[model samples]
Target: MSTDTTTEPEDASLEDLLARVDDLETRLADLEATPDDSQKMVVVATKGTLDMAYPPLILASTAAAFGYDVTVFHTFWGLDILHEERSSALKLSSVGNPNVPVPNAIAALPGMDEVTTRLMRKRIAENDVATVEELVDLSIETGVDLQACQMTIDLLGYDEDDFFDGVTTGVGAASAFREMVEADVQLLV
Candidate 1:
């Protein structure tokens, strides 16, 4: 005679639990087989003004610090960001800037842009914020590749010598686009 005392429902529940465990194990194995997706970053700088220039540099350097390969492609007006003569002196515009306390009408007044630019620079200095030059240096030090847009340089009649010393190369839009498409994170700023 058999002495097994387990009920039919209890045995069925045990089988269900084992099946669920197997399903979960399979899922875990699939997850383990997947490759990492956090490798590259590409940033596009389209504007050259002081306010517009900081984002690409800051993000590229920060990503580099996190061990991601970083590239910043400068195009059009953004070419000034890589210009040796103007990178440090890019000015913040008060016109149409909602963050400024002054009304748009007042901000658009003559010389208001200069005033706002001076104020912004003073505030940045007071707060120990990194200037564009410093951020560019940091990005370069962290192995961020700075690229100038060749089409823009040619259109604007600027020579390679016009760019800062840290630029890795001058490339066309297609090259920059390729980098953007390949990057895990692509930012346009």
Candidate 2:
């Protein structure tokens, strides 16, 4: 021991490190015994024009499938996606590009948004995609929860009951924002 006196400091440092390692081992065991955190996901949809819908609800539904508690909050143009009577009226833009896959291509020509929508309505029988209405039907069948923004609904003079069946209530922006606070993942689709 006297010959290796210089190594005393190294021995003491090693002992201290070993003690800390033991403490960490206990903490790791405790954590392993605890339950996993419940994952959260929030999806927001905006823009109700042709070809712009289906983002938030689909993403939310998919996230919920992965065991994450999912919530979809619709606002502004996005709210149109959840309309019970009007959702079927939605169309896709197919202008300037003929090969693009759109529900109703004629609905988006130069300053012809409205005209395109009208044309789409006339040809609804022949148009390919099932339209937003069809998607909503399938979405509801899969147990997806859809929520429309209260502020937007009121602003647009839409009745609360007029939204899709899955929508139970309308919520203000503050409440929507609060819902995202605990979310492990939040996205604006």
Candidate 3:
């Protein structure tokens, strides 16, 4: 086959036209795919323990670090992250948390529950891992708002004084639920 020795014309106008079309199509597709402001994230943690305490604060902090506005609602045992004195006293129970290393000697020891709880807290500190308090601090530094359950506190005979300073507010389930519903992701960590 003989090839034609001819050059095709390059049209700058044609390229610009195609680029504009692609951009508009992409924008329309995105708008159709999901609602705007549905990117918000909410994390709720309802447990307070050496093992479970980090989720609410850690998840909220990390999410906020990623440039997403994150809110953490702490309820029930999860409220300990804000506890003034007992926050550090959060302990992992050997009775349920299988990940906790339990030596046979410690298991057989009298008052093993207390002994293990103490050991759990010590190990967490020695490892330099973030405590519930530290994670809560990070969340605060990252602009992650904290909400403690006032109902839980009142039932426990506690008050705002029970929580650490810099906490944004204490609210009930209704307020927390409203925030969660507004968020794209609602999770119980």
Candidate 4:
């Protein structure tokens, strides 16, 4: 059988539809050409536990790998994520973590935190996952900006020496807020 070849219907409706389609395509191209929100990402790290700390560091590093300008603002307990002494030793807090197999009462018992933390670290190592210290180094090497919360530092009586080398001068929440406002993507991890 021969293939059928037909020209346009030569009707106003079909012509109008084609013109609309062209307009839509042009607009779609314009939209695609515009800068993506992922161009910049700001992550707030506010937890110190092993389970809670990885997300911001991981996301910041991943964004940096994508050539995004990424900043991780460590506040409150999250300060441990960048602490030179504690970063590698950040413990899993099973007391309130629902994912842990232990009941809350058992988890809250003395010595349970140590057990849980060890188990978590063992699992992480077994899976060949990067440690917090490794992720911190990777993030710095990849140009991820890390900032410590000045207020928390003062409140916790922590000196600048407590943090790793890559952190910027401590920043208060206001500065972090300004960065967040300018960021195309923001996360509290």
Steric collisions counted per model = 0, 1, 1, 0
lDDT of each: 0.88, 0.71, 0.76, 0.89
Candidate numbers sorted by lDDT from highest down: 4, 1, 3, 2
Clashing pairs in 4: none
Q: Which regions in candidate 1 have their CA more than 4 angstroms from the true location?
A: 1-38
TM-scores for all predictions: 0.77, 0.61, 0.71, 0.78
Query: Tens digit of lDDT per residue, candidate 4, span 78-118?
Result: 99999999888889888878988989999999989999999
- Model 2 misplaced stretches (Cα beyond 4 Å): 1-36, 93-111, 114-131, 141-143
Clashes of 1: 0
lDDT (Cα, tens digit) per residue for candidate 1, span 27-64: 98998899665699999899989889988998899899
Which residue pairs does candidate 1 place in steric collision?
none
* Residue 162 lDDT (model 4): 90
* Residue 81 miss distance in model 2 (angstroms): 0.6
lDDT per residue as tens, model 2, 1-189 = 485776888898899999999999989899988956878777777768555675665566567678777677788878888887767666555565454444434535465555656666666548664556766665566555567888889888899888877784657778778878978888887
Model 4 quality (TM-score) = 0.78
Error of 3 at 44 (Å): 1.4
Candidate 4: what lDDT? 0.89
Best model per TM-score: 4
Arranged by TM-score with the best first, the candidates are: 4, 1, 3, 2
